[model samples]
Target: MTVITGPLAKQERDDTGALLQSTLVDLLDLSLLAKQAHWNVYGPRFRAVHLQLDEVVTTARDYADQVAERAAALGVSPDGRAGTVAENSGLPAFVSGWVDDGKVVEAIVQVFSTLITRMRARIDEAGRSDAVTQDLFLSLAAALEKQSWMFQAENRA
Candidate 1:
């Protein structure tokens, strides 16, 4: 990898890289969760929820890419294999292609809730380590929270 010099300190870059690697697992796990739900969700509101799930799945994939790039920027390879995700993801694996919508929603809520907590912790770490990473995580936390609200809204509807 080419050298990077910015306002970021060397130690901060290292820490941000570690944080991004850990977040790589979260993003991938979350991506699968959204995809699984997208493919399997069914109910009275099936069509609408299914479409929303598709949007979530797509966005999750993008988020995964961003985090992986962050890891690569730090000179460490990002883990992309399913096996690595199985071993490293802090969130539960969502593998079934056929599941009840309620169950799917509940499971996804559980996953993103973990994401909120994890992102907050990472934000704290980055706040101390790298302002750039911290800025990114701050925006990420807001987006994830907004996504969580979307999931929460389903129950109210």
Candidate 2:
């Protein structure tokens, strides 16, 4: 078990730091997955899909930076290396090959589902820590759920 020895207690800030650290790994994985889809996606909607996927990766990178800096503030070591990210991420292993548009969306949906699940789990962990972490997680959880809902909505339409 990782023991925190800093002056800060295991309250909202620590919980927030942990969540951010964990989320960073997933965001990095998402960025890479988006890139993979961008490169190999084919059939109809190739250009649009590829461009959009590229855009998501770009956005995710910025999110990763924020999470990494937050994690650092709490004096926790970040699993920022590619190998560490692969090991830490909750997203399933990516299946290689040219993915059809629907399959691409489905795969991304699965990844998002896992991400939302992990985020909720971290929120629970924050509860054990205290109110501040809980509130921070509440905010992030809401945002993540909204994003997940949008992804699910796209697939349903």
Candidate 3:
């Protein structure tokens, strides 16, 4: 039962909602993974990597809100519950306990790599269904790509 309605048609709203929902799950998981790394990162580059992880957390959270709000605007219920994110997110899981700075960077790079690829596909798909959602995906892709590049730089030998 949706109380809100936007300009999108039913099919457009449905497709956009699905795209945003997937993006929401990934973004929520990304924030959690980054926070976990932020708490346990160690080694020579600990300070830098730890701070960078915080940046990722902030980015993911900010975008998650945007995506969720976009869904709500379209009369679609947004689900960011723990179970939903855990089951639906496409992001790679982070190892538990303390992690080396190098490993953290490697893992984050991998996450962003996978997320960016998926975001590109969503962007393309949304382009056909809803340009507004496609624009959001494009913005998200830029930010994720930038973060990925920064992490990749740290991982370089």
Instruction: Supply candidate 1's per-residue lDDT for 104.
Output: 72
Candidate 2: count the clashes: 1
The full ranking of all candidates by lDDT, starting with the best, is: 3, 1, 2
- Candidate 1 residue-wise lDDT, 1-157, digit = tens: 6455445557777778789878888788788878778888887778877887877777677877877776666555777898888788898777576777777767777788998999999999988877766777787788788877887877633
* Clashing residue pairs, backbone N/CA/C < 3 A, model 3: none
lDDT of each: 0.77, 0.71, 0.95
- Candidate 2 stretches greater than 4 Å from native: 1-7, 10-17, 130-143
- Between candidates 2 and 3, name the one with more favorable lDDT: 3
Rank candidates, TM-score, best first.
3, 1, 2
What stretches of model 3 exceed 4 Å from their correct place?
Answer: none
lDDT of 2 by residue, 42-115 (tens): 86767766676776686678767766765665666667898888788878866798888767767877877887
Which tens-of-lDDT digit does each residue in 20-67 have in candidate 3? 999999999999999999999999999999999999999999999999
Cα RMSD, model 2 = 3.7
**Candidate 2 at residue 10, lDDT?**
62
Query: For candidate 2, which ten residues in a row score worst on lDDT?
Result: 1-10
Which is better, 2 or 3, measured by TM-score?
A: 3
Off by over 4 Å in 1: 1-10, 95-97
- Models, CA RMSD each: 2.4, 3.7, 0.7
